[model samples]
Target: MKKNIKNKLNNLKASDNYRVRRAKDSGNSHIFRFKGNDYLSFASNDYLSLANDVRIVESAKKALDIHGYSVSSSALISGYSRSHMLLEEELSNFLGQEKTLLYSTGYQANLGVIKSLASRGSFIFADQLNHASLIDGSILSRANFKRYEHKDVKELESLLNKCPDSREKLIISDSLFSMDGDFAELKELEQSLKKYEAKLLIDEAHSLGVFGYQGRGLVFEYLLNKNENIFLTGTFGKSLGTFGAFFSGNSDIVDYVMQKSRGYIYSTSLPIHTIEATRASLKIIEEEDWRRDKLFSLIRYFKNCIKKSNLTVLESDSHIQALLIGSSADAIFFSDELMKRGIYLPAIRPPTVEEGKSRLRISLTVDHEEKDIDYLINILDMISQNLVQ
Candidate 1:
């Protein structure tokens, strides 16, 4: 029976693709060691390098003294605490929203928001390239979920028009496309949705601390009406360097999510220490504007370096920069070659990216230096030339 199960597992693996996690013992940066080789990691989501900050560590330790390790239950049960409430208040004020609700992860936030809002007879218009969590939530919502082409306002408008006149409609999109790192046309989307009288939802999982004047993401970046019927979701796992997610909107939406969103109602709340750490991280993001500036400068620096290398790179103003290699085998080979050179960049292939457009996703942070960027450029230049040869 065990042999049969192993054969079934092997068959399942052969049917698609499988990926394994490599161990690392360090904080955020492009350079890390794994399997006894040092590799330049261009793949972490810690955009601001606040995850391992000393100040955050101190705050977390303080909270641990006050709140203990685990809450032992979901927030609705016995997990709600003063620390969680304080962070919610801070997040609400920071985002200019009426209220904010927290979840254990960004994926759960997306799932809770979609599954709770769009129900039977409701319509949900999602971007073609929305995150898998959003897609899963829409499917599980039992609503008439429609996907428009990515960033196409006209396509979204047309789909909204086709929905029954009496049906409630919600349009969902990522403010920053994670894989591509391009921003959504929020102004156009807002206008189009208003024409159809449908509400809009923006997931700022990649934009929370990385965009806008005050780092409020695209909502403020485009000057959208703050008190309008728009929903915004952000994650601490990325820029905030914490381990939870939050959704902000009107108070009623918060109440509804708290009461009805299964993902939130059932899941355990984030640790109190994490909440305190996240609050401190947000302060760092606001007080240390230089970090953001440094991040952008590094992005520009790296982009220019790649351009000087005469390599084709995706047009991205965000922290994520990808180099299209066009085949999984090619991408894997490039990543392996870079690893052998003591520079690590993991291969991103089909499922994460399209089969024909396999590319290297490079995540930049303030922790990386000018020399690190230069070394990466040199390595990529050599790899590109050899691949062409």
Candidate 2:
């Protein structure tokens, strides 16, 4: 059995798909220290750069003094605290949702939400490249799962048309495709949902604190609140620069999920300090218009740099940019080459992305300036020239 495991591991290395972690000898930021050297990080998801903000840190410290770390039980038991209630209320108000339920992680939030709302007789239509958590949740729910092409609303509608069940019909997708860094066709998807009378669930994990008025998210931007059939999930670990996640929508549905979600019910709740810290982050997210402004500025600057250099960049106007370098081997080579030049963007290989679609996922944060982006572009150009030789 050990021999078989060894063989599989060896196979991954040969395929150039073996993964390894680079231990950052520092905290979260646009500059990461690894192996005793500082490298400009184009790999962080801390969009608003709030991970190390003093206000958030102070808030967490205050909560620690009052609540003393972990809540020590599940939300339903004795774990839910005043901090949790306040955070939930704050998130609900920020997102303009009727209710919200917190989960330990974004994956858990997706899993709990999907399984709670879907069942054996239900039909779940998801995007082909929806996050793995969403895909897993659909499968685990014992529902009839159908995947439409990425951003193909017509295909989704066709599938919805073919399903002849009176049971629940739920459509799930990411508000922003994480790897591709493209916004979902929310306007089209909403029209499809309305036409088919289907329930819509969107994971705003990557878009939270990055878009919409005051970073409320795409659902708010697209004006998708016609009814209670829409559900939204997002995480604080990315754009908000904190931890934990949530599923929010209509009051009745959220309450039902809180009661029925096995993942939420079985897991210990988030620590009070983390919840309090998220509250601080949300307050900053709501008030800090300059952070968003600076990030979008970086996005535009980076895109122009890529274009002027004639680099192969995927279609993305958001903070997440995909620099598509064809094969896994070439992608790895490019990543290593970039690291040698003091930039720490890594190769994103399959199955995170399609084979031959391996690329470097560049994440822009407010902490980065124009010079930082210029350096990245110059290094990319240098690497491209070397690759040609």
Candidate 3:
């Protein structure tokens, strides 16, 4: 087994897809300190730059003085607390959903929801570029998994038409594609749902605290009201600058999943401090309109800079910007060259992205300024000038 593992590792290295982690000594923000050097970072998902906010930290500290650390058991057992219940309620009210349930991570939430809702004899239709967790959930459900071309609601409807009418049909998609940085055409997906009589599961992980009406999410932005057939799964780890995740829908579906989801029943609950911290983050997310304002400003500046530099950028509806570098080796070289110039951005490679589609996924946050973008564009322009195909 060890020899086989070694051989697989060698193959990954040979493919230029081996990944390495760099420990940042400082808290997450626009600048990350690593090995006694600081780099201007464009790699964090802290979109509103709240991860190290003093207000959130103080809230966590207060909760720690009372609840210590983790709850140590699942929500179904001794782990669920007033903190969890209150947070769930808050999220329910915020998202305009009838009910909500907390999970250990976004991955667990996706697994629990998809598997609980769709089982054997059901059909799961997903976007070709849906997140790995959503794909895994569909596979685990024992459902007939069908994938359509990315954002192709027409293809999705065609697949739905082929499924038996008596069998349940669930369509899974990410509201925002993290790697390619595009939106799932929710309006078109909704039309398909009505025509095919299928339920939709939209993962709003990347859009939760940065998009929609004051960050309610894309579904709200488009539908203006929750549809009975649409459910949402999201994480606090991204724009919220916190940990844990959640699933929300109409009361009946939420209750059914609560009873059947093994991931929710088997995993430990998030720490009380983390929950409290998320509450504080939520409050800030609602009140601090300036953060999103500043973030959009930086995004526009970055786009202008990229346009002027004559660089290729994948279409993005939100803060995530993908600079296409083509191949894994070339992407790595671009990332390394940026690191040498004190700009921290890592190459996004397969299987995070498809082969030959590797690129630098730049995450713009509230803390970044126009000057920072100027410096980055200058470095990228210089690198591209000398880069060999």
List, in order, the clash count of every candidate structure: 3, 0, 0
Candidate 1 global TM-score: 0.95
lDDT of 3 by residue, 297-387 (tens): 8888888888888587887757889888889999999999999999999999999889999999988899888999899889998898888
Tell me the spans in candidate 2 whose CA falls farther than 4 Å from its real position. Answer: none
- Residue 232 of candidate 3: its Cα lDDT? 95
Could you estimate the TM-score for every candidate? 0.95, 0.98, 0.98
Inter-residue clash pairs, candidate 1:
30-41, 39-344, 40-344
User: What is the Cα-based lDDT of residue 302 in candidate 2?
Assistant: 89
Task: Find the 10 residues in a row with the least total lDDT in model 3.
Answer: 217-226
User: How good is model 3 by TM-score?
Assistant: 0.98
lDDT of each: 0.84, 0.91, 0.90
Give per-residue CA lDDT, model 2, range 1-389, as digits (tens).
Answer: 99999999999999999999988998565988997899999998998999999999999999899889788999999999888898889888888888999999999999999999999999999999999999999999999999999998889988999988576799999999999999999988888888888999999999989899999999988877546899899998998888999999989999999999999999999999999889999999999999999999999998888888858688999999999898999999999998988999999999999989999999999999999989998889888888898
Cα lDDT, model 3, residue 88 = 92
Deviation (Å) of 30 in candidate 2: 0.8
Instruction: Write the residue-wise lDDT of candidate 1 on 114-182 in tens digits.
Output: 888889889999998888888888899999989998888888888887888789998999989888888
Using TM-score as the measure, what is the rank order of every candidate, best first? 2, 3, 1
| lDDT score for residue 309 of model 2 | 89
> Which model scores highest in TM-score?
2
TM-score of 2: 0.98
| True-structure RMSD, every candidate | 2.0, 0.9, 1.1
Clashing pairs in 2: none
